[model samples]
Target: MSNEQPPSEQPPPDTASDRLLADMLGLFNRYERETAAARASQGDTNPYDLAPYEDVHGVTNEYEAARDSDDPRALDQFLDNLADGFHLEDVRALRMATAAVQAAMGRIALAARERGMSPDRIAAETGYTASRITQFIREEKQRRAAGDQ
Candidate 1:
């Protein structure tokens, strides 16, 4: 059976998604202008002026796609390329992840000490190689030491 789709019941919602989509479209449309401006910076006098709409979705899509591929090197490259234009929330997320990893390692070391276990033994029990455990311990120790100075 054929059914005609009803028109929207109300006007479009003016939410963040709509704003971000509009910005992405604006940025996509500005590619040629950006390229000309970049070229002009290299000394072409008559080049187009770039409107410079920051595309959050473009960066996020690239970042998520790289991260989903399970390759840290690719993710690292994506981060490096993205850092200059990334939104503040992305920076906060990165900072949070760094802190969480550091805190987890600190907890493991503290728990190992409280249990009277040699870190190497703890590492073996936990499936990390002794060298990795040592490295983690030393990193936290060094950070603490530097902070004390």
Candidate 2:
């Protein structure tokens, strides 16, 4: 019997396309490793910088103006415009802005509660869940208690 292996058992020869794909995969793996290393070196610090203050301020102003109008269409339009203007780097700034707005809403809800508004009524008016409203109220009460101590 011949010593040659059967065709089905032989390995396929590498083509130029296969080499290119291998090279691309290697580069991608290297890039991912480097990114992970960099992030690890930062030790809980954010790697990306916040967006420019002017841009954040402008967006905040636009949001407030739209919200003040009390028109659903205006708010939708504002959101669409904000989405259109968003870039990858704006993530942190957007998060900060969102936190600020949430804090403001919490304060307003607490004030409304002080004025005898129930959590259910606040939730219905603000489109937030009643549980979330209650949570806000609890947090406010905790804050006041801490201040009194």
Candidate 3:
């Protein structure tokens, strides 16, 4: 009834908080894209960069332990730390995936330890079937032998 433009005629708009959040999200998205490109260019997906974790709460050893723990919990904790430290949502998913694999590996090693259980036996029960539990055991041993304390 008035001369005012209809709602449909109004231009799309962004609020102050909306713009702030969008800017923040964009910054993180750019980082993820860059990191992904870096990994792809290297032909690897290791996800074990010791640089970013450095200088952040002195968690260097913790992160390394998580990587090598072969324990699911370790991987989860590692990813959580990374996400919390960097405030990135994508890393949350990466953390879950990493934790699952490591946990399965840990179970495999544990299965190999059960009574008279060969590495194969352990793998069968644990669903990993690494077929070379010896290698896992050996690596674990070496890691322990090196005074991981």
Candidate 4:
């Protein structure tokens, strides 16, 4: 007997996954635009300063492209390209940017928790666990306390 299912029995499209992917792409695009505007306002036109921005954006664009693909070598390709195109200095700058983003995220999570949002609710929105959300809030409090000292 044939194992193939009829066309009427085909699985439904994963609208939830589609929506989530769309939202992620939108967020990335918006962040890119906002940062570009902020850089333009600051007159940050130096080629040296701009290289890192371009490199970071390239990485993100590559990531998004790879993510939407089905090839198993997407990650390998990204790594190979990164190694070929980026320097240690670029990676260090990316680390700094990552740290800044994490700090901002922690602060935002803390504010949301303080405003009575449940940890689970925050987690749902952020793709983090409830425990991680609570941890961020606690770390943010500690950071503020240390800053005040």
Best by lDDT: 4
> What lDDT does the true structure give each of the candidates?
0.69, 0.76, 0.65, 0.78
User: Which 10-residue span in candidate 3 carries the lowest summed lDDT?
Assistant: 45-54
The worst-scoring run of ten residues by lDDT in candidate 4 lies at: 44-53
Question: Please, what is the TM-score per model?
Answer: 0.29, 0.39, 0.29, 0.45
Tens digits of per-residue lDDT, candidate 1, 45-149, equal 335532112444455566669898877699887767666555787677767876886678865775675678887797876667777777777777787788999
Q: What value of lDDT does candidate 4 attain over all alpha carbons?
A: 0.78
Per-residue lDDT of candidate 4, residues 1-149 (tens digit): 99878857956547999778767987998988888778868875432344534755555667778877799899788677668767988778878988897868879899998899999999998778999988998989999999999
Quick one: best TM-score, which candidate? 4
Clashes of each: 0, 0, 1, 0
RMSD of each: 16.1, 17.9, 17.1, 20.0
The TM-score-based order of candidates, best leading, equals 4, 2, 1, 3
Stretches of candidate 1 exceeding 4 Å from the true structure: 1-103
